[model samples]
Target: MPRKGMRSLFFSPKVSTSTDSSTSSSISYFPSPSRFGFSPSKPSFSESVMNRTLEMAEPIIMKWNPETTTFAKVTSLFYDNRKEAIVFIKWVKNLQKAMQLFITGNSSSEKLVRAQNLMQIAMKRLQKEFYQILSMNRAHLDPESVSTRSSSTSFLSSISDYGEEDDDEDTRIVNESITEVEDASSIAMADLKLIADCMISCGYAKECLKIYTIIRKSIVDEGIYKLGVEKFSASQVHKMDWNALELRINHWLNAVRTAVKTLFNGERILSDHVFASSDSIRESCFTVITKEGAIILFGFPENVAKNSKKSPEKVFRILDMYTGISNHWPEIDSIFSFDSTTNIKSQALTSLVRLGEYVRTALNAFESEIQKDSSKLHVAGAEIHILTTDVMNYLSILSDYSNILSDILADSPPPANNSVTESYFGFTDSDDSPAPPITRKIAWLILVLLCKLDAKARYYKDVSFSYLFLANNLQYVVEKVRTSNLKYLLGDEWLSKHDSKVQQFATNYERLGWSHVTNTLPEDPTAVRTPEQVKEIFKKFNSSFDQAYRKQSVCVVLDSKLRDAIKVRLARKIFRGYQKFYNAHGVAMQRDRNSAAVVRFAPEDVGHRLSDLFFGTVDSGSGSHSSFDPSSSHSRRP
Candidate 1:
């Protein structure tokens, strides 16, 4: 009896063998009507049906092998003539169909395993063959090799015998080769994608990823190797180890940075059309190369907390990398357009402002991270402070290139009305003031640095020292800015504001710094008391002065002019008051010749002593009052 649906393959009537032992035991054979002629004369019905069924089943049985020999044959064909990618692809499809049928039709584990092994071999072979074809096509499309091939061909043709038929045949072959090369190169990407898809379908996902990686790497390799070749050459690309490849990538990035820097510096002039075209090409190429890296980095599954908690060191490294490139972005973007519609200086200013915003964001992130880690406050704060300082330094360097800030700083104050000017200057007009983009940026940077410094100052246990530190740093910043071209950009208003702040600091210092010394002085020096009071006052003054001087001597005052001004102000305030007290009480103290009435310091001696107070050199005995002239030329009091 035939299995269900088996009878349809042959021209035969259904044979029912049942109940009768004789009929069930008997077997019959017959010629298949589609295969051989059936005898019309007295042929047995059972025999003819049996023979037809047998003939039909023979081919089906032969096709049931689990190994699927067709795949192997297709693989061989692909290897032999990989250029016929269309034909190879068709065969691959057939092999896939055979694989599906074999998996579904077979019941034995051994046969299924055999089918699996065969498919693996086929896929492996296909990959190998695909790679070879791709490589060959890439070589042919390579600009350098193309030129070499063309030149060689031309030379050969020029020297060849003038046999028209042979020459024509050779030309036809060359044309055909050229066409094939073009076709291959054009289809390479599509073919790669197809191959990856096929691998994925075959449950070779790992292989698919590798294929994508290879494609990305090839692009990067080509870009690096062909950078200055003029004629692009795939032949020059060699397989690099991971370290070497990383080095190359860094080299390329640095080159890009250099190019961008030059563009910003306005060193290179390019037409709008050419610049746009080249820029597009560069962007596209970089996108292709970086895409795979981005995918690989982000594709993996990771814990949210773990992924979010990047180490400060790593974050800083990443920031440094970005900052290194971003530092040049302003100049790059500042490049003047060939069309002359955009002002280069204005563009530079915009770029600088944008860069400043980015840096601000980074700083905010850094501070936020530090806030989360309280134990490392000092360490992190110091690092952040350094980073901010570096940003300021970098901005200073940038300012040198574009005097946009300087120009803005030098902006003339708006002209006053004739009445106002005549009233103020006793004239209708005054000299034009000079007139600043990064001016704002630098100002912002300074503000940020101050904030950071203030934050760091909180780490110190001593509030007075912290105040002193702030005062010293703030004074230094103001002095540096004032002395540089930055003074113009910062403007008179800014200078005034900072100067006022410095005065405030000095006031704070007086309250905090001079408390001990001021306590020793009598508020009303004109009123005289006993000689005991006079002696006590001078003794207390000398002791307090020595103590205060020792403490303040090591204190930093970076600006020399600021230091001199501070010293002179201290001298006049202390000495003038001390001299008043002595003149009022000295006569009375002379009347009492007690040991307490013996003055340790004359008025001139006191003046001399005040000079040495700040520097911790108060000598109670040495009478060197000549060098301590309080009325000597000095910086005007703040």
Candidate 2:
């Protein structure tokens, strides 16, 4: 059963006269010794064999070795003596394969293609012969023999190992003749000077400058564009194409640096001033890129910079915002004044909560010290309440003086550069699309807070190991105040007007300052509501605030007037005070588990103004909260 082309490469010639001995032998295809080594294990799985070989060899093959003088030299030799090399290579392949089959001792049981490699050498085939060879050396091709051959022969040494891993590691020879890369393009300063002089002589000074810019930008990106690839007919300059001008600065690196500084300094300037100033620079420096040759850094903001005319987009985008904030710092100063003595009987849910959490976390860090100090232990809840009240009041009234900001946030939402701006700025058409107004933003915060409280009150009843920490999550409370859903309760048209003065002010608050808002009345202030109406409004804010207190791990404050103000009318004309949240998110409104609380935490004696803080329950009918009952009959004290 010997194949016709068997032993083609190894045997010198084929026997002219075919005999019975050869026929009885059934093709003894004993192969010659192979260069490429192979040693099969005992009847191993073919899949594993192929898998292991491929896994081991693929890595070696993928590695590049361009600096191999040996390979380059061998290429010529291979092409010249192609026949001899091919025959030798086949002989080596066959011998090792046979050796592997012999060692594995797996007698051939399946039909296979002939192992004969070269048609040019011997004119015989090889399927049966290969089987005979496998049978003949099954015992001799053992692990021991294979190991001896592997150790004795320097088989791989002849092949040049000049890749990154092999050449650089084993040998310290740096051959100059074997170059891997071509030389780079070089344009000297002297050449540039000569070119400039020549261009001036030719009455093309501007063209020369334009050419210089093209080279500068392109060189930065592709590194001189490989000297050999192109003809520098006009010197890498005249062929320029650039993006259109937009006052958008994506200086992420600088912004990141500013952020890091703020993080370490804990400064408001870093959060507010940094972004405002950078954005201002970007917007205010708008110049028509008239000539597209060289970028004239000096002539930016063609209209605005050189003269008095300004881009409305610039005002909306940067100038109005930053300059207004910068110049009107006193307004914010007056509005943000905190009253350390006053307790916010009515709270700004999210704001109050965060301060409480911060205090709690601070105390928890040194719980041993806190517990030991009798005064600290006694005043812990009191301090939290006072701080919570202060924070709530401040945040609640923020809407009053920041109407312009509220409008900016609601009507025209814009991208914020820093923390302070990000927190306050709403996405708007002036910025992106009109942002939900600041009041609405606060409303949304309140709604979310209400949802969270509702969820905690409604769903998380069973106290377990996981539920234990639910008692002290002040951050969650702050979130409610920060993200109150005011839009749903207050008509979107009223709360989030695109052309509202509030948004315009907000977009320009930083530049104009807080005084502009504190002194001015809302163009359309919410109509006063009767205490008898909107009872639901008071309830929601109350529940959400209660949740805030609960989050602080302190006893909840169930105020009378505060609870009774919840109703429908107030929901329609959402106020800037604490009642706004109470109406929208506590009971009738949808609740989200992760929603922020309406109020924030701050200690008593912290200065805050009703004019400064908004988004709370206001009893127009009763005029004051002193007349309210704590439990049943909801009445506001005059």
The most accurate candidate by TM-score is 1
lDDT values, one for every candidate? 0.45, 0.27
Q: Determine the C-alpha RMSD for candidate 2 after optimal superposition of all C-alphas.
A: 31.9
TM-score of every model versus the real structure: 0.38, 0.17
lDDT of 1 by residue, 216-251 (tens): 356434443444212212222233333543344344
| Candidate 2 total steric clashes | 143
lDDT of 2 by residue, 516-619 (tens): 22222122223425332334333443454334323322222133222222211222222333333333333332343333332221111011212111113333
Let me know the TM-score candidate 1 reaches against the reference structure. 0.38
* Stretches of model 1 off by over 4 angstroms after superposition: 1-361, 366-466, 480-491, 522-526, 583-593, 596-598, 602-638
Task: Pick out the ten consecutive residues of candidate 1 with the lowest summed lDDT.
Answer: 297-306
For candidate 1, what's the RMSD? 21.5
